[model samples]
Structures are given as structure tokens and as C-alpha cells.
Target chain A: MVAIAIARQTVREALRRRVFWIFLIVAVFLIGLGPVLGFLTPKESQTIMRSLGLAVILLAGLFITIVTCIYLIPVEIERRTIYTVLSKPVQRFEFVLGKFLGGFAIVFLSIAAMGAVFLALVYFQGTTRGPDAGVLVWLTSGKFPKEMVLGVVLTFFQMMLLAALTIFFSTFATPVLNFFMSFGIFIVGNLSSVTESLTTSKNGLTSAIGKIIHYMLPNFGNFNVQNAIIHPTTEISNQGVFIRNNIIYALIYSAVLLILAVIIFDRREV
Target chain B: MATVIKKYPFETVRRRMSLLPAVLAGLGLAAFMQGQIDPDAKQFHPKDNFGKTANGGLNNEFLLLPLLGFREAAAGLLWVRCDEFFHSGDYDAILPLVRLITWLDPHAENVYITGAWHLAYNFTDANERSDRRYIAPSQSLLEEGVENNFDIPDIKFELGWQRYDKIKDFKGAEEAFKLAVATKVNKNSDDFPYGAPLKTLHILAHTYEKQGRIPEALEEWKLAIARSEEMLARSPKDYSAKSLHEAEVRNYAENIQRFNNRYSTTGHDSVNPSPYPEVLEPPPGSADKTPRSWDVAFKPELRIVRPKVFKVGGQFNSQDGARIDVRITDWNYQDRKITGTLNDFSVDPAQTILIDSISVRKNHFEREMDMSKDPKMYSFSQDFYRVVLSYNPRTTAPHLLDRFGWSGEGMTDAEKSHVFMDTDPDRTGTAYIEGQGAVPPVWDGKTVPFTNHSQPLRLIKVTYKISREQIMNQKPISENDIVSVQ
Candidate 1:
């Protein structure tokens, strides 16, 4: 019952925010631009739509996670509302969990609504163009020699994990700090494979730096399945299995980050 | 201030609030979506004027504005498809489509080369069924591109290659290639990482070859071969560029050899050992008259027709209307003439040899065969009462088709022995002629209907049926086979 209460309160707060509506309008515009995008490309309309859809989900999710964590908790403290809530029998962990769930829910809703629209557009494009981009993707799947789909799924999760990492950081750091730190992490994580290669390189100092980066930086490259997905004809079955494992790994890693954020928030002086 | 506070802003408030954001947002969005909406917009407008970045990105980077990027990539693919059409001699669609692509993305260098080759070569498929009109537009587009982008060497190379391959204008090709070599190639490492020096070397080598400078071309091909070998040695597993270079060097060497062979008398008469035993040489001072055997033959069924096989330009059949005339000579004795009358002497299997007569001297014989009739079939006789020799009634199905004509279905013994005597099963083992007696000695009823055997014994006039496989396998035949009759 208490968890339900927290979830509802977080939901109410998300509804009241103007940025949520801004994200919703952006989502609608991008989704509505689907048919126009279809008309423009005429070749890879669905592929473009799917890619843009994923990006919208990511951008909106990031915005919600960042803005909520950065402003929500800080604003509560600035308004001295934390005292009112904390003076009650409520625990700090519950407040943090509730806030995180609220943000997660809002992002999930946007992802669901936007993903459905994107799929619908893909279906429409497929029917109109007579296997435009999406149907070719479908027919090429099982009929030919394709690489594993799991590798691609893993990469997608890895990107989502990066988003979660940003949210976790925003819980503790200033929005500007979180933004730079997350962006830097994202860039470094994309290049983690290149760094990992450097770890075994000839240059001693460079290898040392590479090793440090390999350990210190989050490897977001694991979630990238764009190449495999785009080239579905050459996918290996083993890669698909590998992606499933990586998805679990990314989720666990994100969970660890959330736990760390909760711990940090629990001990805050505010 | 009191005057300004008068109620004069009712209409202004309504108008300003609505129009300001709408116009700003609308303009901004329009600017963003301009490429998406328009097909012939400033798409792929060259940004890199060989040095400075054009618009936002270098080398037309801003031109890749997602909408245009997709189109550009598609055009690149269309270039490849157009090339296939051009190669298949589908010039009807090829010329216009290629022009459209170049108009869309003028920077496409490969399309120019491929399309130019199609037009210039005017090389038709075995079917020879497509229109010849594509050549004019193809050449025009290439010339236009050359005029438009006179600085790009790749375009000039395309022109030069087309001239050399299609028009046989080697001198003109050489001049164009030289011009291409003179172009200042991109020196920036990032612009062309492998650098243009190697590319220049290649162009120069091609120019030399086109100019008939064999020694220079051979040297260039060898150098390229050495460079490729070195690269391959360093990275044995890497197939990317090493294989391409190797293929180029090999093709260059082959072309040089072919050029040399065409002009040299030695190449004209060159013949390796025959697969069959036709030449007979006695051992030194031995009593045996048989030739030294390369392979041991026990009772080998030797079959030899008078006139030493068929000749395209030979004259006269045997006087007996069966046997052909021949002259025989022995190194140890005086040359002798053996003349015999060829009777019609129709047998179950009549050997068609159109002989005049045969004369036999002491250990010598000669016979003459006539070919005066136009694509006619005649029988030959060794003896007056009985035909001693008959054309092998059961010619292998593959043998007949390969020599006389390709029916492209099945072969019969009647067809092989009577109609297609030149058919050698061994030369073209995979193919067999079908529809016996229906197709003429030369005509099987299809496009470009004429074919000669590896030995050139028979001429097939094709009018019907497909050639099967592909005509691309012709070069390998001409290079390795095509026996010289020196």
C-alpha cells in the first residue's frame, strides 16, 4: 500500500511538469513525421523510422531521467519540502525508490506509445512500398544466412544502461556536471572497444591508460546491434544468444548503479 | 507616456502573439526539411573545393543531410545496377538512368567508368538482341562529365579506358590517360589514405600499354606485381587490396603477352604436343616404321581421313565422287603420288569425305579432297567395290555440338557423323548438340549465329536455341586452345 502511494505521488509530480508535455509534443511530432519521412526516403523509410524511433525513446528517456533527478530532489530541498516528508514516518530509501520508479514509469510510457506508433508506421511503409525496407528486413531474416540477433539486442541494452547511468549520476551531482559526465561516459563507452584493444598495445603508457579506461569507464559498446540489425542477412545465430546474455549483464549493471544512487541518497545531509 | 497608455493595442496584441512564434518555428522547420521535400534541391553540392570545407562539412559533408545522404547512397547503388544493364546491352534504360544518377550525384566516379565502357565497347552479348542506341547517350554523358569536372582524373581514365576497349583508339586512349596521370592527385593523407602516387603509376602503366609500349607496360605490370606481393607478404590473411593488385598485375601481363603474340610469327605457328597421335617419326636407324609412342597404345583404333582432316579453303572432291586426293612423302625415299578413284559406294555408314583420287607410290601416298559445294555433304570411298572407311556413326553427343553446332538439348549419332564431323568431345566435353538435321551446318537459329570449333574443322550457323552457360568463357578458350595450323 505504501509503495503504491509512492508510485502515485511520483506519477502526479511527473504529470505536473511542463517538460513532460514538451517531450510528449516532440514525440508526437517525430511520430507524426513518420509518413513524411516515408515519402522523403522512399528507400529505407522503415529503417529510418525505427532508428529515429529508438533515438526519440532514448532522448526522451534521458531528458526525463536527468531533469527529474536533477531538479526534483534539488527543488524539494530548495522548497524545504524534504523536511515535511522526512519528518513523517517515511524512510529516505522509500523516497528515492519512489522518485526513481516515477521517472522510470514516465519514460516507459513514452517509449511504449512512441514505439507502437513507430511500428505502425513501419507496417504502413511495408504495405505501401511492397516490402519497402521493413519487409525486406523480415524476409531476409530466417531465409538466408544471418548473424546472431542477440549481439544487436545486447548493444541496445548497453545504450539504455548508459541512460540509467546518467540518471543515477544526476541523483548525486549537479545537472551540468551530470550532463558532461554522462556525455563523456557515453563517448568513452562507445570507444571502449578501441581502448580495450589499446590495453594489449605496444606502448606501455598508452596500455596503462587503456587499462585504466577499460576498468573505470562503462563499456556501452556491448549494446550496439545497429550493424547486425541493418545487415540482417549476414547475422550469426550465436550473436543473437550473446546479445541476450549482454542484456542481462547491462540490466544488472544498471541495477547496481540504481542501488548505489539509493545508498548515496540515503546518507545525504539534506 | 500618458499618450502611449491609450487603448491602441487591441489588434496589435492579437496579431503579434499569433504570428511571431508561428513564423519563426515555421521557417526553422522549413530550413531543416528542405532537403526532405525537394528531390532536385542543392543535394550533394560539392563542399570541398579541393581544399576548404563547403557549407558545413568538408568534401560535401553538409550535403549528407540525412535526407540527401539516403538518396546519395541509393544513387551509388543505382550506379551498380545501371552498370549491369549496360553490360547486358540494355542501353535503352541504361543511358537515361545513368544520366539521372550523374545529375543526382556528379561525384560518382565509378558510374562514369562503367557506363563509358558499355557505350564504347558496343560489345553485345551472345544473344545480340539489345538496341545499339545506348552508346551515343552513354558517350555524351561521359563527355559532359569530363567537360564539367575536367580536374578529376578518374573521369578522364573512364574515357581513356572506354576508347581503348571499345573504339580501339589506343593512341587517343594513351593521350587521355597521360592527361589523367598529370592531374594533381589528393596529397592529404585523410583525403585519400593510400595516396595518389600508386594510382598515378597504374594510370601511366595503362597509358603505356595503350600506346603499344610493351617493354614499358611489362615493367609497370612487374612493378605493380612486386608491390602487391610485398603487401601480401606483410599481411597474408588480408584479402582487401592485395588480391585486387595481384589481379591487376596478372591481367596486365596477360594483355602484354596477347599483344606480343598477335604481332609475332613465332606465336602464329606455335603448337604444343597434340593430345592424339597424328605425327609419326621413326626411331634412329630402326626397322620399325611406327612413331615413338608418348603413351603405350595396344591396337589403338587409328582413324585418319584423306586430305589430313578438313580445310576451309581446300578445293575439289575425289574423281570417284567418294575419295579425296593426297600427296605423300618419305624422308628416306622420293616423294610419291598415289591416285585412286572414289566411288559413291553408299554403305550403312557413309563417310563424307569428298575425295578426287588417291595415288600410292613405294611406301608413299597422297590424296586430294574437294570442298567446292556450298555447305554440302559428300561421301568418300577407299575402294571401288566397297567403301573401306565410314564416318564414325556414333559421334559423342558433346563432341558434335561442340564442333558443328550447339542444339542445346541432345545429340544423335546421325547428327554427329553426317552433319558435324568437326565435333571433338574432348575439347568441349560439357556441351552436346541437339535437334539433328533441323539446324544447318552453320545455322542453329539464334542471334549472332556462327561458331567455329577449337580445331576450326566445322562452322556452325546458329539460328535457334540458347548458347547456355555464358559467352564470357570465350576468352579462356581462345587463350588456351585455338590450335595453330602452321
Candidate 2:
């Protein structure tokens, strides 16, 4: 119960920040610009709209996670709010878990908002012109693209993982340092396949190092099904297995990071 | 103080150690996921490093950008650039860009096909000056595409066409076409039209024909016919299949006729006697001697002329030998003139008599040869002579034939002999002049009377007969042996 209250308080605090409104406005404007940018490519309006929409949603989600979660604990400590929070009956683990959940909820809401705008743009662009207009019409009439929805859901899970990482860093590091560290992790995690490919080498030294890195880093690329959404031909054949694997992976990784954060916060001097 | 510090240390250790199992479990799960995803996911890797570094390294600048995750955007942009280059006729610039686009998204099968098309068709055609530097590269690109997209038969078909039409490599074309047919059969996609497979089979058969593998070509044509018949049976309104069926049917009939004519009773073996048996006959001093000469009556003054823009006249001077005088009085162009020797002149059945130089001048120039100097020039019963004048235009001027008052079309018999020059300035032209005259019979009883006939731009037919004994005793004859008769 105390954890739930803290989570609610964290959400309220994040919502009050200017960064949240800035990201929200930027994301909305970007999604709205999809139609205008799509007009530049008259023949490929549908493709352009979908691409821009997905891109805006992803960028907005990343911004909300990194910008909000990076400063969550640091500002609390800087403003002596951590002393007040610690004076409560809330345990350190509950505090860390509540912060993560609250940041994740905000990220999820932002993504949902962006996704809605993207879907609307996709509908408008489809009705105007393009080869996929028929599909768009079918979708708007009754049926919906479960694949596209799955893409948005998976993207939310990815941002959730990022949120956990940012909160973990904020527990110990300054906001600026945490921000750079989170961004670096994102880059390395997304391109983890490059390191994984190196592990296949016959050279022992290189392969050992690659294997360590591959196992240690999160594989953000696994969540990228945007291509499958845009190019239907490339959709995963066993989508059930893919989604299950991703959910399991994200839950395990986020739990590990959150636990580490709880341990660090419990030992730290406030 | 010591008790409190020790108690706090133990609590801290307990709290940290409480999460060790979960961390270990997470690490184990990550390892398992890595093992499961790597091999199955390798298929999604682009086949080539076209846009990457020479050593297959990624472009860090692009990779660092969040937009790199959106592969479609990169490919679409590259595709637009390719269109721009194609519109501007900068085919050379489009290759690497298209290659990079394909690399960025290998599953875009259309990119591979379109890129291969541009390389093989547009680029190859652009080098129309016969500088075939792009042909191999174009073929290589298609072959690479086929390797990457093994399921796409259209790409293989394009490769076959590239080999057949552009490179003229018949064996390569046959292999590529066969692979395409096999892929089409395996896939059996409904979108693939019936005309496509039929067209490939037809081209394969034609390639076989060009390679002189006539029997194999006939078999392929038969297979094509069968396939077309099947298609027609399935869809009776398929005009493409119907036309292909009819065409293959005609081709089958024509191939059968050709086969029979080449190998059956009407072949060269049946019409001509074996030279081996005649060569084995005993020499003149041997016991098996037979009369070799026989009298054949033929016209002696028959003159055959090839009409061109220039004029040539010849006469049979009995005191000497056959003489031809070539004169070009209408030579208006000073830049070009025709010159060469009449190296090959034949008398009777097969004898080259005159191996001398004869120049074509502005006026008349005659060459009279003594036939008696070479005994091989005369025949016992009849004499027939033929002369070949090889001419080379001695000028760098273009359109020499057109400038010499020679119309490429609608030429009379007289004009045919005069307009002997070919349209291409680089090639040499030859004019054939043959005639017949009486040979004072060496061992004949009566001289046959014959009249002279003259025509321009026509082969002079010489008729003579000889006994088996004369043929056996005749000097060793060859196609190169020149002879003149008077």
C-alpha cells in the first residue's frame, strides 16, 4: 500500500515537470506533421505516414523514459525530499520499485498517446492515396491491425526496460551522468548483434570477450518489430513464440535491474 | 559500538545476498536467450556488405542515429535517389546506391530484381559502342541476387536473359534458364504467369540451337510444346500459350525436316562419291587402266557479270588465255579508289589457274595468261574458267559505296556488277567473274558447237564431262589450284 502511494506520488511529481509537457507537445507535433511530410511523397504516402508515426512514437517514449527517470531520484535527494520519504514507513525496496513503476506508467501513457496520433495519421494518409489504402480502409471500417498494436505494445515494454535502467542509475549517479550512461546502454544494447556475431569467431580471446558482452548487455533489437508492421511480408511466422520470449526477457531484465537499485538505495546515505 | 557495527555489517550482507539468486537466474536466462536467438536470427542478416565498409564494418554514423532502426526509411530514401539517377541517365551512379539499399533491406525482393534489371538491360544497352565492359558486371550482379533470393524465379530468369541476349553466352544462359524453371516448378506461385515458364523454355531451346546442339534443342522444343499444350488445356483462352504452342509445333516440324535432310539419303554423302575410293585407284602405269576422258558439250562464249557501280569486261583470247579488263570511268570521288589482285581464277571443275595481281584502273586494264604454261589449266574435253577479284577501298572516306552512285536498293543487273562495294567501309568486297571457252581437244573426236551468253552479277555455269580414266590421271586437284582456259 505504501509502495502504491509512492508510485502515485512519483507519477504526480513527473507530470508536474516541464520536461513531460515539452516531450508531449513535441511528440504530438511530430505525429501531426506526419501528414504534411507524407505529402512530399505522393506515391508512398502510406509508407511515409507509417514510418513517421512509428518513429515519433518511439522517440517520444525514449525521451519520456530517459528525461523523467534520470532525474527522479537525484532531484528527490537534492531537494531533501528523500529525507521526508525515508522518514515514512516505506521500505527502501518499495521506494525503488514504486519509482520504477511510476516512471514506467508515465512512459506507457506517453507512448499510448503518441501511438493513437500515429494510427490516426496512418488512417488519414491511407484514405488519401497509396497502395495500402485498401488495407487501411479495411482496418478503419472494422478490422484492426493486431500486428501494429503488438508493435506498440512491444515498444512500450522496451521503454519500460529503459525506465528501469535509468532509475537504477539515478539511485547512485548524478542526473547528467545517468543520462549519458542510459543513452550509451541503449546504443550498445540495440547493436548487441554486432558483438554477438563476433562471438562466433574461432579465435578464443575475441570469442570469449564477445560472449561476455553479449550475455551481459540487453538485446534491445529483439523488440523492434516495426519493420514487420510496415512490411507485412516480413512478419514473424511464430508471433506467439516471439512475443512470449520478449515478455519473459523484459520481465527478467527489469526485475534484476530494479533489485540492484533497491539494494543500492537501501545502503546509501540520504 | 563493536556489537552494533558487526550487526549492521551482517544485515547489509544479508540484504545484498538476498538478490544473488535472482541475478544468477537473470544471467542464466540471458545466456539461454542468446543461444536460442543467434542461429535462427542469422537468416535476417543482409547477405552482402554493400553499404558497409570494405571489411564488412557498419557505418557508425548511421548506426548511431535512432533512424537507422527504421530500415524502410533508409531504403525508401535510397530508392528515391536511384530514381533520380535513373532519370538522369546516370546508370553508373545508381549501382552502388541500389546495392546499398538492397543491403539495408535484403528482404525487399523487388529491389534486387529492379537493380539487376537496371544493370543488365539499361547499363548494357547504354554501352552501345560494343564496349562490353559492363556485361560481366551486370551478369555478376544478377547472379549475386539469385544467390541471395533463391526463391525468386524472376531474378533467375532475368539472369538468363542477360546471359542470352547481352553476353551471348549460350551455356551460361542454358544453366540460368534451367535453374529458373526448376525454381518456378518448386515454388508454383499463382502470380507467375504461364507465359513466363514457356518463354524461358523457348529461349533455352533457342540457345541450344545456337550452340549447334541440334538434338538437344529438338528435345527442349518438344518439352516446350508439351508444357504449352498443358497450359492451353488448363486455360483455353490463353492466347500466349496458344501462340507458343503453335510456334513450337512449327519449330518441331522444321527441326525434323532439317534433321532428315542433314542425315538421310539427300545428305552430302549420297550426292557425292567418296574421294577415298577414287584416290585408291591404281596409278597410270598400273595394270588397272581405264579411259578417263569423256566429251561434254557446253557453250564456250558464255559470260557472267556482276553489275555494280563500276563496269568490267572480259574476253577469251584463244592465242593466249582468258583475259578480264576492269574499268571505272564514273569515279567522281577522288578520296577513294578500289584496288586488289584477282588471286583465285579457276578453269573447269576445280582448278585455280591465275594466281596473279590484276589492278582495277580508271580505264581498261587487261590480263591475258598463257594456259599452256601450266598443263593443269586445260581439260581434255572442255574448258571453263572463273576469276575472283578482291577489292579494297583505299580511302578513309565514309559512305564510299553511297558516294559512288550506288543505290543500296533497286539495282539493275548492270548496276549490280558496278556497285560491288559493301556498305561497311571497313570490310573488303569480292566480285566473281566466270566464263567458258572451247579448249582445243587433246584427245577428242569432234568439237561441240556452242553459243555465248552474257549476264551481269550472275555465276557463270560451266558444263563438262570426263571419263573415269582422265579423272584418275589428272594432276592432283585442290580447291587452291588455279587454272585458266582459252
Best by lDDT: 2
Question: Could you tell me the TM-score of candidate 2?
Answer: 0.59
In model 1, what is the error at residue B174, expressed in angstroms? 28
lDDT of 2 by residue, A145-218 (tens): 55667878888888998898999999999999999999888877766557787688799999998887777777
The parts of candidate 2 lying over 4 Å away from their true place are A12-56, A116-150, A225-239, B1-13, B47-59, B66-68, B89-92, B120-131, B181-486
Question: In angstroms, what RMSD does candidate 1 have relative to the true structure?
Answer: 25.1
Candidate 1 chain B, which ten residues in sequence have the lowest lDDT sum? B293-302
Write the residue-wise lDDT of candidate 1 on A206-255 in tens digits. Answer: 99998667544555544444332332221123443444445555555565
Q: Candidate 2's residue-wise lDDT over B1-486, tens digit each?
A: 211111225677586779878887887886787666665444444443432323344476544543336565666667767777878988778877766665565555566667766654553211132213334445555666677666656777888887676555566777888887776333124335542456778888776554434455677888988888888899999998798899999987765543333222232233223222121212336565541211111112212121111122332211121122221111111211111111111113222222232332332234433332233322222232233432222210112211111111111123222233232311211111112111222111123211111111112122222222223333332323222221
Scored against the true structure, residue A68 in model 2 reaches a CA lDDT of 93
> What are the interface RMSDs of all the models?
21.8, 5.2
- Best prediction by DockQ: 2
What C-alpha lDDT values do all the predictions have?
Answer: 0.43, 0.56
The per-model DockQ list reads 0.02, 0.16
- Give the share of true interchain contacts found in each model: 0.00, 0.19
- For model 2, what is the alpha-carbon lDDT of residue A146? 59
